[model samples]
Target: MRYCLGLDMPGDAALIAEYENWHTDIWPEVRKSILDSGIVNMEIYRLENRLFMIMEVGPDFSFDRKAAMDAANPAVQRWEELMWKYQVAIPGGKPGEKWRLMDRIFSLQEAL
Candidate 1:
């Protein structure tokens, strides 16, 4: 399955740079956690302060399972805490929610 989500970064250019730098060499544990959670592929894009993520997951993936796994992994928790410094929940998102799932309004395959 594929999921697309949106988030926001602080408007500070320095902070955005730092966030990108961190992704350049993400910690092994953090990478492992993502793989173990059944995310087969992931990509993140930025447009000014707006951020978008595309994730392709295997059949074994579930948000609840991933959340439980992340909660149990101290390294993942630490990484999330560090990332929160640069990330902000999109408007209407719950407090502390970093990514908001986006609704797909149009798809070429569906349009056909």
Candidate 2:
């Protein structure tokens, strides 16, 4: 299923620049973890400090499964830790939630 979510980066100007650099090509290990967790497609967009992401997850998507896989892979865990250094949860957002899912409001594809 396709999922839409949003997150935010640190608002500091310098930090935002650095975050942009890192996203130029995310860590390869991180990509492996996501793919191993059943994320078939992913993309991220930004507007100033706000970030939006779209991911196509498999039917078996499960947070616990992903978490467990991440925990088992130290390289992936380390990558996540490093990435988190630059990212901050969206203001007034849930503590552990990085990307908040968006509800589907309109979709022409839905009718197809």
Candidate 3:
């Protein structure tokens, strides 16, 4: 399965630079946690202060399971805390939500 999500930065150049730097070398444990949660591939892209993430997951993946695993992992917790410094919840997001799942309104393949 594939999912797309959105997030935002504060539009500060310095903060954006720092956030990009952190992704250049994600902590070992955080990477491990991601793989363990059944995420087969992931990529993040940025356009100014807006950010998008694409995630491909295996059949066993579930958001509830991943959330529980992340909650139990100290490294994931720490990483999330650090990321929150640079991330802002999207306008319609629930309180404390960092990434908002995006709704796909169109697919070229489906149209074809």
Candidate 4:
């Protein structure tokens, strides 16, 4: 029910500043869209343009459909286009896959 993704920063300082400003308070509707999508917890962290997001959803969470719906929504699409100006994937990244899934090496919970 939890997922993580990372995004790199843009090379330009001015653009990076702009991006930070936007994130300081993202669009309200965007926030609503996410909350309505069955997400239980979500947060984003940044270390000099290297951004990481952690999201926890219900057992029925479906990123595939949610992603496609987001792509079709004009506001969301616009936001994504603008965001792309500040992010990119590393070499060997799969096509259409931006944030790579990280393996969980350790956890506090014990397997039943």
Instruction: Highest lDDT: give the candidate number.
Output: 3
Cα RMSD for candidates in order: 0.7, 2.1, 0.6, 2.3
The lDDT for every candidate, in the order shown, is 0.95, 0.83, 0.96, 0.77
Measured by TM-score, how close is model 3 to the native structure? 0.98
Candidate 2 Cα errors over 4 Å, as ranges: none
lDDT of 3 by residue, 1-112 (tens): 8999999999899999999999999999999999999999999999999999999999999999999999999999999999999998888888898889999999999999
Best by TM-score: 3
lDDT tens digits by residue: candidate 2, 11-109? 788988887788788788888889989999999898888888999999888878987998899888787777787778866666776767788899998
Better structure of 1 and 2 per TM-score:
1
**Candidates 1 and 3, the one with greater TM-score:** 3
- In model 4, pairs of residues that clash are none
Where is the poorest 10-residue window by lDDT in model 4? 96-105
1 or 2: which has the higher lDDT? 1
Candidate 3 has an lDDT of 0.96
Per-candidate TM vs. native? 0.97, 0.82, 0.98, 0.83
Error of 1 at 102 (Å): 0.7
